[model samples]
Target: MRIARTVGMVMAGGMAMALAACASVVGSTESEVQIRTNPDNAHCDLSGYEGFAASVETPAAISIPNVAAPVTVTCRAPGFRPTSYTLNASADGWIWGNSALFLASGGGVAILGALVDESRAAGKSYAEEVHYQLSPDRPRPVRARSRDGGTDLNLQAR
Candidate 1:
């Protein structure tokens, strides 16, 4: 009987240590942040803007360390307007749940097993990345008119 009790206690201690290790491994206390241009409209042009700038902010920025990821950037020349958009970051790196373990036997052993299983199963982790962009708008130029029976000069801006 004493030997059985000692074995149960040792098993419980091992289970506790395993649960703690799993929790620490899955948790993400760090994150990254950066800047990038919109991949879809890369070829589009916005050369005629007066000024252009972009910025991004997030709640995790203050909480997580080393959050640096660029979403997208758009710029325009003088006489142009500004445009901006937000992007949601992906959460592929997060671990949402835990694995379960079962050990069969008596009433007292079952109760201790329940405690270990509950603690291990309750673990969770979450992470996400967000993106944003800014751009200036430029209106197309108007066509010129002809005078004095001269030829009309209409050149399309490329």
Candidate 2:
């Protein structure tokens, strides 16, 4: 009878461990990132995931899903040259905790949990904050002395 009770307790413990997904439980499938520009209020567009697109003004916060891919951010403002940035995902540190879970739950349950996290991309994240700097579209004009002693206007793009 005591042996049977011990077996039941062990089975219950295993079941509980199987349900503990390190990344899903401790981390998130999405994270919020702050976007800022040298001059505020630039129109920014974010894309990468299919059917997922967002637009916002600079100096804002955006919540993006965690994926094993890159997200592109493009910004534009009047009189300023447009700029684009690629946001890459890095592995979340919490995902590594699954290795520790192996010791507690044995290899099988821990591996299962890790696979679930991998499928859901629960262990990837983008940078917490991103900043962009845009240059002016118009260039300054320079005055040069011509051969006839007349002033000439030289338009240069710098």
Candidate 3:
């Protein structure tokens, strides 16, 4: 019984350590995420961007920390419709590796070990690239021919 218990403890420790390293963090804490807008040079503001510059013109790159929360951004350009979008910060898939540790770690220890691993590794990250599309303030007229032959339909802009 003593030998069995000793072996179990050692196995648990090894499993925990191995699982910790398996975590594949998609992006690093200081990874730079490029932010761009279709209109270029537009003003852009990002939320939850760690300590890096939260505000910058479109076509700019900024470093953001890895976090579980999604990042939000708003972009605006002259004579263009302001646009807002969210960046997905998904949890690392290697977290599943922790599940294998349950047999060795028993219960809470496995979960705690996994959490510790994630904290030490990349926690979360915005995508490598974020792009936003903004539409012009005024809708361009569409040229359409009337069903009555040669007549053109002219719809005035509101």
Report, for every candidate in turn, its global Cα lDDT versus the true structure. 0.36, 0.82, 0.69
Q: Which scores better on TM-score, 1 or 3?
A: 3
TM-score rank order: 2, 3, 1
Q: Residue 158 deviation, candidate 2, in Å?
A: 8.5
For model 3 the local lDDT of residue 84 reads: 83
Q: Clashing pairs in model 3? A: 66-124
User: Model 3 off-target regions past 4 Å?
Assistant: 1-31, 49-53, 117-123, 139-158
- What are the TM-scores, per candidate, against the unseen true structure? 0.32, 0.76, 0.63
At residue 111, candidate 2 shows an lDDT of 89
Ranking by lDDT: 2, 3, 1
lDDT of 2 by residue, 2-99 (tens): 99999998997776575557788778988899999988999999897645688999899998888625788899999898889888878889888778
Predictions: Cα RMSD each:
12.1, 4.8, 6.1
Q: What value of lDDT does candidate 1 attain over all alpha carbons?
A: 0.36
Model 3, 72-153: lDDT tens digits are 7889999898888877666555556666666655766567656675665454455678778998888667777888798888
Candidate 2 Cα deviation (angstroms), residue 89: 2.1
